[model samples]
Target: MRKLLICILSAVLLFFQARAQENIQLKSGDLIFQNLDCGPLCDAINAVTQGYQGNKFSHMGMVLLRNDSVLIIEASGKNVHLTPLKTFLSKSAHPHYVGRLKPAYQKLIPTALAFSMAQMGVLYDDQYLYNNGKYYCSELIYDAFKAANKNKPFFKLFPMTYKEPGSGAYFPVWKVYFEHLNMEVPEGKPGCNPGGISLSDKIDILGQYK
Candidate 1:
């Protein structure tokens, strides 16, 4: 009886362990969104843009499993690059969430990933302009999927606004940013942002992690 009870307990433990592992396993092409609290710059972005599901995520990346390791393809800082998934999550100020394309769109994953891989080392778009030979985070996703869809974009680009919600004036930080760049703010320019893409109905929320 003692041996039987021990075996039953071990089985229960193994079952729970497997469940935990399944919960965290990420598939290739999953989208990870996070709010990175890098400093005042990130705060400025969160202040201006609204996010979906009550999350004010300021950054995003696409997941890829290469050679048994999970990696994130993101356009950040100076260029588009690959980052380890663990390290990517560590940079988030809020818990990150994973989103996946709906079942009907699953067939596009390989093509999208291939497009993203081809964009490796592309310059990051600090100006956040469309067709500028540089890409911001969400723009990378937009372009990748667009290519996958043979130039028919899966996501739509809306005219960007840098103003605080309900206020007609631009955010003070945006003014500063443009001043630093010695260029006018591209207000009303067609572009994509992480917050907007997070709201897309084509994706299903998979999980959240801190």
Candidate 2:
């Protein structure tokens, strides 16, 4: 009897959730509307979060919401948080670093993406926190990038700076994964960096090179 009651309750909860999703009117081409492919998406999400370790970085999860006009990307993480749009402009120390498109990027990009990437970078380059000798991949990325503060969106979130690796590939690809986007760093140059804006080439940067 207890088991049967539990199953009934679970079904009821699922029914409500499905109803809620149905009510969330979405735009025509938003990915969430297509098919719920949790398999690949979950793996991708795991990659990004695992990218950080040590030096105090947050663990963030992505949430996608679709509206009549736009797609929203909400982030929920351990230390990182979502600052309300109104409060963000005035309350945030680095307002310039905040993303304007936070509400519309949950599918591929979360609102706190830049900061998350910073954390990922730290993990990719472990040497930065070797002295501490106790860190994870994602935590290191957060510590290192937060220290550098070179990338406005990412830097504003990080309070301090640390030694950083010279390459984007240092961190786990899944967390800071850039699918179908081109990031040309000015530092590397020509053969190495080849700086240029992405035209429309969809490529995942986080894949393991080896």
Candidate 3:
């Protein structure tokens, strides 16, 4: 009876351990979003945009698991590059969340990842414009899926707004950014943002991690 009870207890521990691992396991092509709390720029982004699942993500990346290691393909200050998942999560101020394309759209994963890999080393788009040689965080995802869909974009682009949520005036941070670039804020321009894509019907909220 003693031996039998010990075996049962061991089985219970193993079952819970497996369950915990499964919850943290991330599949390739999963989207991870975070609020980095980097500075005023991050603050401005979260203020003007919306998020799904009650999150306020200001940045995002695509998951890529290779040779038993997990990496994220993201466009950051250094441009589009692959970052280890552990390093990626460490940069977030709050717990980051994952989003996955619905099963019906899962078939596009390979093509999208391939396209994203091909874009490694591309410059980060500080101007946040479309069709430029550079790419911002969500723009990389949008373009990759668009390429995968043969230019028939799976995600939709909404006219961008830099104005405060209810106020007609543009965010002060935006004004300074564009002025430094010596260009006008591309208001009403067709583009994609992380917050907007998080609410996409094509994706379902997977889970989050700290």
lDDT for model 3, please: 0.89
State residue 121's C-alpha deviation in candidate 2, in Å: 28
Which structure among the candidates has the greatest TM-score?
A: 3
Q: Per-candidate TM vs. native? A: 0.86, 0.24, 0.87
What's model 2's overall lDDT?
A: 0.27
Against the unseen true structure, what C-alpha lDDT does each candidate score? Answer: 0.87, 0.27, 0.89
- Candidate 2 lDDT at 19 equals 67
Give the per-residue lDDT digits (tens) of candidate 2, residues 1-210: 999999999999978766654454333212110111234433332332222111111221222233422322222222333323333223222111111112322333332344343333222222212324323323322333334344332211212111134443433343233222343222221110001100102211111100
lDDT of 1: 0.87
lDDT tens digits, residues 82-175, model 3? 9998899889668787889999999899999999999999999999999889999999999999988888988889898888888999989899
- Candidate 3: C-alpha RMSD to true structure equals 6.1
Better of 2 and 3 by TM-score: 3
What is candidate 3's TM-score against the reference? Answer: 0.87
* Model 2, TM vs. native: 0.24
Candidate 3: clashing pairs of residues:
none
Residue 94 in candidate 3, Cα distance off native in Å: 0.5
